[model samples]
Target: MRLLGFGLTGLVVLLALISLVLGPAAIGPAESLYALFTDTGTPLTLVMREIRLPRMVLALGIGASLGLSGAAMQGYLRNPLADPGLIGVSASAALGAVLAIQTGIAAHFAFGLPLCALAGAVVGVSLVMLLAGPRGSSLTLILAGIAISSLAAAFTSLVLNLSPNPFAANEIVFWMMGSLSDRSMSHVWLALPLMVVGWALLGSLGRSLDALTLGEDAAEAMGIGLRRVRWQVVLGTAAAVGAATAVAGAIGFVGLVVPHILRPLVGARPGALLWASALGGAAMLLASDVAVRVVLPSGDLKLGVVTALVGAPLFLHLIYRTRREMA
Candidate 1:
């Protein structure tokens, strides 16, 4: 497990380096690395420090947030399909951002949009917890999450529908599609703190999650607090995923896919999967961002679109495997 964790960390670092070098303007790997560290006010330095670095940071941060949250949720819920998106946190956060955009508050206040999204995430997760209860069954949690997702999506559509500004509507639509292009360090600054907090909250649950694998009663008998675990998972996921969606606009499946891919490497230990999934998710998103640049240098391809293209098939395979297992 330690070896696997180290391997993933190295992979993520490699992908981050690759992300720094690959972009519209051609920069050699060595030069890019140089500019990243020593800024000499050159165009390459400006691009490296101002643009690519932030995008790389966000890609890693958002991916880690989603991945860690996914692992924590899956462990807490003991369900393979449990994810931030499954509980409507992403959708709700998107709606908050959309509202900010439509109201023009985001334009005036730099942090307005992200703050609103963070609030929406908190509400969404809280509602999910309320509906599903602290100790709800897997089916109950899924149903509650679906209900929350549907409601949030509808509200988001309604906001778009009522907007009189066509450009604003189009912008909202495009943003919802998700991307990592032309992002500034401000975004990285805005989302990183919340994501870090979320990571800490979730990471603290390693032992609890491991105990959970033995069943709730067994975990309880072993002195684990189920209620505390639920709160931590819910709030932590909201903070991390909400901040991510605020900056990146609903990049899905990093959470859903990363843990599943790396779980085997961690010997299927939920607690041990957290850091591995975080590193794997960062690597995956960085690679996807690189693919977007190469595949569509014209910037036509969205990050979310690329992830969905990859994740949807993996999702189907997971479902098939699950069915076979049940059979």
Candidate 2:
């Protein structure tokens, strides 16, 4: 299964490479490789270097970030449905990005918006934890996440409403919807470090997550300290989701859907599934982003819209499956 996963992941990377090179003014693999490294002055080289590379990197980073974060959440909560978006983490990050754009913070510094989004994620996790409380059940955590998301969303709408500038308001509207067009390498560089750190933290949780399969009490008996695991999950998820949102806005569904799709292929083991999910997620997201470009040749397409179009139905399917299992 692991070998199959690695092979699948490699196939996805190949597809991403094809996507990167097969655009309207497409370049061959050799040319693309040369352009990617040599950084020549030809138009094809420039396009491959400047336009496609950044977008590909953004897709990979955002996908991996969402995928691992979701894996961590599912592992920690002992529920397949527990994802970063459901827990208000992504919403908080989006709210923060929106606030930054509307208030001229992003105008001051290019990286300001993503940084603020990261901050928002931190606050969101803090609030959700507070509301969930120590003895909270899985249901309690989900409810708290919903409550926190609603509150954060309201605050975001309120902030936008109170803004004096109409342009900023319109900008805020687009920012919330989420897209990857016109994103520079600066955005990629801005969020990648934190995402890397977050991935490391999440990946390490695999063994802990496997222990969690036996239930929290059993995990504790096996010396997996529950409190420590909880903090690690929260902090690790916040880092990944927040950083990705800071760069890509609120990209929904990738986190939730990736884990569900790959879990079975990895034999449903947390210890082995974490990195597999990350690679699968990167491939999945890059594929989706490539699809967006192919479908909308006229202009840029919304990243969230593409993911949601694919993700919404997948999420519904998961819910149905969960219900069936419970029944």
Candidate 3:
């Protein structure tokens, strides 16, 4: 497990460093590294500090959060099909971003979209929590999440349909597709605190989740409070995924894909899978981000689109494997 953990961590670090240097600019890796640390007052330094650095940071943080949250959710539910969006936070955040764009708030202010998106996430999670109640079962939680997610998706679609500005509609569509472009350190600061809190909450669930593999009754007998675990899963996912969707627009599948891929590697232990997925997710997103710039330097390619394209095939394979195992 230590070797696997170290390997995944190293992969994440390597991809992040590559992300920093693989932009469209013709800067060499040596020069990029030099500019990243020195205040040389050059354009290269500005690009490194302002553009690449924040994008890299956001990708790392957001990806890790998504991966961790996904593992936590699947562990709590004991279902491989589960992902962070099962709680409606992502849809709610997207609704918030849609409203911002439709109301021209996004056009008028830089942070309006993300702020509103974050607010929507909070509201969505609150609604789910409220509807699920304090001691609701996992089934009830799933139902509540589905209801909230459906409502938010409906509202988001309505906003797009009612939008009078084609340009704004286009912008909303692209934003929903997700990208790491044009993000700054301000965006990082805006999303990081919540991500950290979410990480702490989710990471602490390692022991609880490991116990949970023995079934709820068995886990409780082992002194694991299922209620506490539920709260951590819900709140941690909300904070982590909400903040990520707010800043990066609705990047999907990192949560779904990373945990699924790493599950077998960790001997199907949810506790170990948590951190492994975090590192794998960070590497995945960083590699994807670099690929976009390298493959389509002249055109805009959204990060989420690439993820979805890659994740869909893996998801199909997962389903196949599950069906065979069941058989």
Candidate 4:
């Protein structure tokens, strides 16, 4: 337990240091650290404050939210493989933001996009839960999620196709690809408070999740309120995930992979796993974002694509190993 805690802490600290120091510029760690408090190099200071800080803040915010949300979802459903996007919640949120952008509503109302996305996520997940019934049908939930995701994707496409404005299609495509580049402080502010609220709500679900490991009937026998627990995770997830998708678009893989990777280190307890995943996720996405800056010099690489590159293999490996273990 001590070693696991140390390791997670070390990884998080090291990753944060790397994110704050390393960048596309030639500013070394010494200079960057120096300029952190003292404004030495005007250009480097500007880069750190105006550009990198906002991006880093966003990286931490969105990554942590996704990780915690995934852990919560897995706990709520007691499914190791369950994910928010996999459950159709993320797709619905994305569609909502896209629609807002298409109608030019977001231009006038800064918070409109995220608000719409939040509403869309609520609707999508509501439909999924309704379809799965009160029992939360595991297989049916997955199927319902898939069906809903497909429908949302189709509708988003149809909207783009029907729009007279040509920019809408391209913008929507790029938005879905997910980039953290050139995002303003406004985006950071928009997501941070909401994500904090989500974290608090979801973080409290740890004990409930631990109880849920015994199955709903057993848990209820132990005085656990399963319905309340379910809402805590679901609504909490939607808010955080919606806020994240609103700002950074749809960056995948963090939520799915972070908790699983850290579960052993954090112990098998879902609660411990949840907080650790948030920290680990902040590390992962920040590192990935930094890596994107280093790898491609021509243009800004989409954060989602980078995560997908790493996460797709992990997903495949999980499936293969699961098969082996079962076999």
Candidate 5:
């Protein structure tokens, strides 16, 4: 486990460096590093500081959030098939972004899209909690999340359909597909605080999740408060995922794929898996972002599209394996 953690951490760092250096600009790696630190008011400095740095930071932070949340969710539910989106925060955030685009608010204001998306995520998570009620079971929580997700998705489609501006509708569609392009330092400031809060909440759950793997009765006998744990998982996931979606749109499969890949390496211990998956996710997303630049430098290829292209095949294999085991 220690070795695996170190490897993943190193990989994340290495990929982060590559992300900083690799871009449409033909700057050399050493020059890129120097420019990043020196900030001599050169165009390269601006590219490094204003563009590459924030994108790398957001990728690292959002990827870590998704990976940690996925591990936490799977741990709490004791279901390998579970994903971060099962709670519906991502869907709601998308709806918010879609609304901002369709209504012309995003076009007029720089921060309008992310702000509205954050509002939508808050409403979505609040509704999920309310519908689940204070004493609701895990099953009840899942059902409530499903209901909210479906409703938000329906409304999003409605907005797209009713949108009068073809350009707005096109923008909405592209944003939903997810990208980190054109994001600024302000976006980093806007989303980082909430993501940190989420990291704290979810990171603290390692021990409780370890206990949960033994089943609820055993966990309760061990003095673990299942309800508290449940609340933490929901709120932590919402904060992290909500912030991520607010800025980056709905990048899928990081949460779903990272934990599953890292689980066995951590001896199937959810506690150990959480941080490991966080590192793995950061690395995965960094690599994907790099791929976006390398594969389609001139054309627009979304980060989410790259992730889905990689993750969807693995997901199908997981399903096939799960069904075989059940049968």
Candidate 6:
């Protein structure tokens, strides 16, 4: 397990470096490395520092958030299908950001957008918990999440539909599709603090999650506070995923895909899976971002779109596997 963890960390670093080197501006690997450290104020330096650096940071940060949160959620809920997006947190965050854009709050206040999205995530999680009941089954929680996601998505569409300016609406639509292109350091700064806080909160629950694997009754008998664990999972996911969506729009499937892929390798232990998922998620997103640049050097291909194309099929396969096991 330690070896695997180190391997994942190394892979993430390698992918991040690759992301730094690849771009339309044609900076070589050596120059990219040099420009990253010493800012010569040249185009290469500016591109590396201002443009690609933040994109890579956001990709790493956001992907880790999704991955960690997803693993934590699946662990806490004891559900294989649990994900940030499937649970409605990402959709609610996106709705909050969309509302901010629609009402011009994001334009007026520097921190208004992410704050609103965070609030929305809190609300979304609260609703899911409330609807799922204090001791609802996994199926009940998933159903509740689906309802919340549908409702939030509908409202987001309505906000876009009612916009007075076509151009503004277009911009909103593009942002909703998700892209790390043209992002600056401000975005990295905005989301990083909240994501770190979220990581800390979630990472603290590893032992508890390991306890949870023995079933709720066994976990509680061992003095694990079930209610507290749920609260931590909800708030942690909200902060990390909310900030992620606020900055990068609604990039999905990282949380879903990374955990499932790494779970078996970690001996299906939720506690150990947390950090592994974080590193895997970062590598996946960085690689995807690099792929985006390579595939459409001059055109636009949203990061969210690329993830969905991959994630949707994997989701179906998971469903099939689950059914087979149940049968």
The whole-model lDDT of each prediction reads: 0.87, 0.82, 0.93, 0.81, 0.91, 0.86
Evaluation by TM-score, superior candidate among 1 and 5:
5
Q: Where does model 4 exceed 4 Å of error?
A: 39-43, 107-112, 122-148
Task: Quickly count the clashes in candidate 4.
Answer: 0
Identify the runs in model 6 with alpha carbons over 4 angstroms from their true place: 107-112, 126-144, 315-327
Highest-scoring model, TM-score:
3
| Superposed Cα RMSD, model 4 | 2.7
Worst 10-residue stretch by lDDT in candidate 5? 313-322
Q: What digit string (tens of lDDT, one per residue) describes model 2 on residues 1-327?
A: 757776967867796786677577645778877787885887777777677888888888888888888888888887777787877888888888888888788999868888888889889989998988876666677888899899899999898889899999888887877777777877788888888888888888988899999998899899987777777777788788888888888888888888898888888997777777788788878887888888997776787888999899987988798799999
Which of 2 and 5 is ahead in lDDT? 5
Separate clash counts for every candidate: 0, 0, 0, 0, 0, 0
Worst 10 residues of 1 by lDDT: 134-143
10 residues in a row with least lDDT, candidate 6: 133-142
For candidate 1, lDDT tens digit of each residue in 179-219? 88988999898899989999999999999999999998999
Writing each residue's lDDT as its tens digit, candidate 5 over 264-313 gives 78889999999998898888889898999999899999999999999889
**Cα distance off (Å), candidate 3, residue 308:** 0.6
| Candidates ranked, most accurate by TM-score first | 3, 5, 1, 6, 2, 4
lDDT of 6 by residue, 1-327 (tens): 989988999999999998888887755799888988997877788888888899999999998998999999999888777887767888988888888878888789987777788778878878988998877665677899899999999999998888997866887788788889888899889889999999998989999999999998899999998878877887788788888888888887888888998998999999999999989888888888888889988899999888888778877887788799899
Worst 10 contiguous positions by lDDT, candidate 2: 18-27
Instruction: List the candidate 3 regions with Cα displacement exceeding 4 Å.
Output: 323-327
Least accurate 10 contiguous residues by lDDT in model 3: 19-28
Best by lDDT: 3
How far is 109's C-alpha from truth in model 6 (Å)? 4.7
User: Is 2 or 5 the stronger prediction by TM-score?
Assistant: 5
Residue 20 displacement (Å), model 3: 0.3
